[model samples]
Target: MANALLLALALLAQDSQTGGQAAAQGPNAPPTDEYGYVAWCYGALGGYANLYDRVMPEVTRIEKAFPGPDGVAASLKTYPELRAQAQKDLKTFASAITAAEKASPRPISEYGGAQVKRGAAIWQGADSVSKARLAQMWMSWSPPGDCEKRAKTLETKSTILGKALNFNSASATTQAPPPETPAPQPEAPAPQPAAEAAPPAPAPEPVATPKAEPAKTAPVKAAKAETKPAAKKLPPIGGNEVIVDPVNPIPCAGSLVPAKRGGRDVLICKGD
Candidate 1:
C-alpha cells in the first residue's frame, strides 16, 4: 500500500512538471513558450526585487538577530547598504530579461502584457509592511529550478519557446493605505506637593491552640485460598487396583501400582 502511494505521488509530480506553466494559464492566455516565460519572469522577478529594496532594511531592523561586529546599532548602520546591493542585482536581472525580450522573435502578446501588469501591480500596490512580510515568505518559497534556467536560456534566442505564464492574480489589486491623521496632544497638568508617610502598624500577639491527636489504623484481614470439591474415584481394577491416568493426573487416596501389560498404571484402592 505504501509503495503504491509513493508511485502515485511520483507520477503526480511528473504530470505537473510536464504540464508546465501552461497548466496554470487559462485558455485566453498566450502560449507559455520562452518569450512568454521571460515576460512573466521579468514582471514578477523585477517587482519582487524592487519590493526587497523597499522593505528589507526595515525588516532587518525589526529582526532580533541582525548580525554585526558591534551590535544592533552597527547592524542597523550596515543593513541599509544591503538595499543598495539588492538594487544593483535587480538592475542586472532586469537588463538580462530586457535583452532576452529584444532578441526574441515577437514582442509580448496582449495576454502576456496583462500577466506582466498583474505581476508588477502586486508589488506596486502593496504597503511596506505587506512587502516586508512577502520578503520573509519568499525565503521558504522554492519554485522548480528549471524556471530560472529556462528563463536564462531564452536570452539570445530568436525563436519563441513556450506558452504565456499565468497564475491567480487576485492579490495583485492590493489597495494602498489611506493617509493617517495626526492625533491632538493633551496639555500638561500642574505639579502637586508630596504627602507625609504614615507609621507602620504594630504586630498582633500570638494565640496558642491544642495539639492534634494521632490517627489509629484498623487491621486488614488475610485472604484465604479457595477449596474445590474432590473428583470422583474409579472402581478397583481386577479386584485389587484401579486404572489411573499418567503421573498424578487425578487426585487419589491410594498408592500407584504398575501393570505388566502396556497400559496405564493402576492405583491400589487401599493405602497402607
Candidate 2:
C-alpha cells in the first residue's frame, strides 16, 4: 500500500511538472488529440474512483435493506481510507488530463473535451447537480475503445471499486416474475347441421262415382214416337213422399168432417 501511494505521488509530481511546461505554452493553446485523450484515460478512471467513493455510503445502505450475495458490505469496509486515496487520485488525474490537453495540438472543442473536464470537476464537487451533470457528460461521449480497456484494467487493480462495479452477479439473485400464463381460450361451438324441409302433404284420395247404365237400343217400330229425355227425380226427406195441407179446412169439398186420431183433434179430407 505504501509503495502504491508512493507511485501515485510520483505520478502526480510528474503531472505537475508537465502542467508547468504546458503553462508556458499558454492555457488556450490547443485541444487534446486522440493520443492525448488516450494518455489521459488514467484520469477518467480516477474520476470513476471518486464517484465510487461518493456512492459507497448509499450502496451500503441499500445492501443493508436488501442484501446482495456478493459481500459488498465486507468489500467496502475500508471505504474511509479508500475514499481519501480516491480524492488524491481525482486531483492527480485532473492534472494529468489538463497537462495532456495543453500539450495536444488538437482543439478541445473537437472532441467535447470540456465535458470530460466538467465531469471530473463535478465528481470532485459531490453535489446532486454535479453528479447529474457528470452522468450526462459520460453518456454524451466515449473515449476510444482502447482507453476503456485501460479503465477496466485500472478497475481490476482497484481495491475500492473492484468487482462491486459488476452488477450482473447481484442481479442474478433476484428472480423476475414468470412470464404471464395466457388464459385458456374457449373451444368454438361445433357447427349445427342444416334442417331438412318437410315432405309435401299426401295428395287427396280420388273420389269414386257410380258407373253409368248402358244406353238401350231404340226399337225399329218406335220411329213414329217422339223421343223425350226422362225427368230427373229429387230425393225426399228420409225417402218418404211429401204431403201438402189444403188451403181451407173449414169444410171439405165433399162435406165437413171432424175426427180424433192419436188422441188429438184433426180435420179430415173426404174429397175425392
Candidate 3:
C-alpha cells in the first residue's frame, strides 16, 4: 500500500506539472507521443515495481528451502522453469517502469488515468508471481505441515499486496478537497419579557351563606307506672316445683324439676 501511495504521489506530481505547462502554453500546442509514453510509464511503474521487489525475494527463499521427495532434490531441480517465469515477469515490469519514468508530465487527470492503468498491471503481475511461488512450493513438498505454513505466509503477503493496491488506486483517482459544508445559521433571539403590570383586583365575595339549623328535639319517653311489690309465689307440689306465673324447669340430682309447682317449690330432687 505504501508503494502504491508513492506511485500515486509521483503521478500526481507529474500531472500537476503538465497541467501547469498546458495552462501557460494556452490551447494551441499540438499533442505529442511523448505525453502518451510518459503516461504509460507512470502507470506501469506505480503498478509493477513493488510486485517485482516482493516476489523476487519470495522466489529465492522458496527455491532455497525446497524439500526433496524420496531424498531427491525437489525445488533446485525445478529451478529452471521457475527462474524462466520470474525472468519474463521481471522484464515486463522493468520495461513498464522505464516507460513511466520517461513519461512527461501531462494534465493531472491524464496522469492519474495512466497511473490507474499501471496500478492494475502491477496488481496482475504481483498476483501471477505470488501464485507461481505458491505452486513451486507445493510442487516441491508433499508434507501437510510445510504446505500449511507456506499457504499462511502466502495469504498474509497477498492480503497486504491487495490492500496496498487498492489504496494506491484510490489515492490516484480521488479528487482533492472534499465539498465544503455550509455553516449553521444562528438561531433567532428569544423575545424579551415586558415590565411587570399592577396586581389584579381581589375576587368579589359570594353573598349566599349556609344557615345553622335548629337543634333536633329528643324523643319523649312514656313513663312506666309504679307497681306494688309482688307477693312471694308458692311452690308447686309435683316434683317440688315452685309456684310462679311462669315455671322454668331446672336439673336437680340428675332429674328435672319445675321451678314453680303446686304453690310449693323445691330446689333439689333425688334420682330414683
Off by over 4 Å in 3: 1-32, 62-108, 115-119, 125-130, 133-272
The number of the candidate with the highest TM-score is: 1
Local accuracy of candidate 3 as per-residue lDDT tens digits, 69-101:
633255455545544544554354344333333
Return the candidate ranking by TM-score, descending. 1, 2, 3
lDDT string for model 1 (1-272, tens) is: 33332232233234336544432442222236655554554554455455555666556645545554576666556545644644554454455466555544557556456656643443343443354454444332222234455655665343233221211233345555788888977877877777777777777777777787778767667767775545445555576555554443465577655553335454443465
TM-score for candidate 2, please give it.
0.25
Per-model C-alpha RMSD = 39.5, 24.2, 19.9
- Candidate 1 lDDT score at position 50: 59
Q: What's the count of clashing pairs in each model shown?
A: 12, 3, 25
Candidates' lDDT values, in order? 0.48, 0.44, 0.43
Superpose all Cα atoms of candidate 2 onto the true structure and report the RMSD in Å to 1 decimal: 24.2
Report the lDDT of model 1 for residue 206: 75
